[model samples]
Target: MAEMTQITPFVNCRDLAAQRRFFEDMLGFTCGFQADNYAFLRRDNVAVRLLEVDFNLDDPARQQMVYIDVDDVDALWAELEPALSKLPEGRARAPFNQPYNQREFHVSDEGACLFLFGQGIEPSA
Candidate 1:
């Protein structure tokens, strides 16, 4: 038997620096690695890699939507509320807590589509 380390998501973004700022500002991820066109960030328990590319023009051609689990949904939503409401257009944005789950929301730095899954319906051990 083998133990498994967690696998993290890497999203291709249009601007590396802007994406770094978004992750840092909203998620508290600090720069883990960087040079020119790419960087790594880790905050709380979430690890994400931002790759620079021009796959989007009209809107970000977001290839990845990473969802992370968190302990508090409302608190994070409060932190992100002002910015999330100011999206230009055509970006899927919302903060929702249904009977089955709880979530906050945001866009990737490239305006590439992304969001957070703060809580979920799960069975207790």
Candidate 2:
């Protein structure tokens, strides 16, 4: 049997450059590779591929949700809060405790892809 090592997700966006900035500047990811219509971004072990596309934003099929497991959700939120706050209304959300025993922070890029950063926590009593 072969062990699965990693998985990278492809995110479709209308503007690759804007998505790149959102990943790099806001999410703290670095661009490992970039081409005319695509870019590979990574931060630590997590990676995402941004691809330029022509699609309807109103289409239900175009919506995407990405969940990221982090070591410390609060810490990560603290670091990203300033940059996220600069985004348009509803683009970012503060950290909050979830019923599933995790603390999570939510944010979305220009392409409307929702990114959730979460860390496991002890269940509430």
Candidate 3:
């Protein structure tokens, strides 16, 4: 049996340039490399390099998803609040009271894919 250690959930995007800008400028992801139809992105400890799906080699049909784990979901979302609000699909998760709870906000990238996620945790005393 093959053991799984790490996995990348890749998604297709329409434009590499546009998605690059959004991932870097908006999402604050660090650029790894860039070619004609492909680019790699990294953010902090998490990484799932992006590929600008090849039309000739593969299909560009839509499939929306990208979930990011963070130390503090609410705080991370707060930091992303302003820019997120501008996103067409951006929807705020209702506020709640709990110790280390789940909070999520959905937003669209430049290519209009429903991407970006935040998972937060409140430390125990």
Candidate closest to the true structure, highest lDDT: 2
Predictions in order: lDDT: 0.66, 0.92, 0.64
lDDT of 2 by residue, 1-125 (tens): 99997789999999999999999999899999999999999999999999998878658788999999999999899999988989999999999999999999999888868999999999999
Q: After superposition, how far is residue 71 of candidate 3 from its true place, in Å?
A: 1.7
Clashes in candidate 2: how many? 0
**Predicted model with the maximum TM-score:** 2
Per-residue lDDT of candidate 3, residues 5-121 (tens digit):
555656567678877888786677887887888777877776655667645422344556676656676666677777666655534443343454545556666553565465654
> How many residue pairs clash in model 3?
1
- Alpha-carbon RMSD to native, per candidate: 4.1, 0.9, 5.3
Better of 1 and 3 by lDDT: 1
Decreasing lDDT order of the candidates:
2, 1, 3
Candidate 3 least-lDDT 10 residues: 89-98
Better of 1 and 3 by TM-score: 1
Model 1 regions more than 4 Å off:
56-62, 82-94, 99-108, 121-125
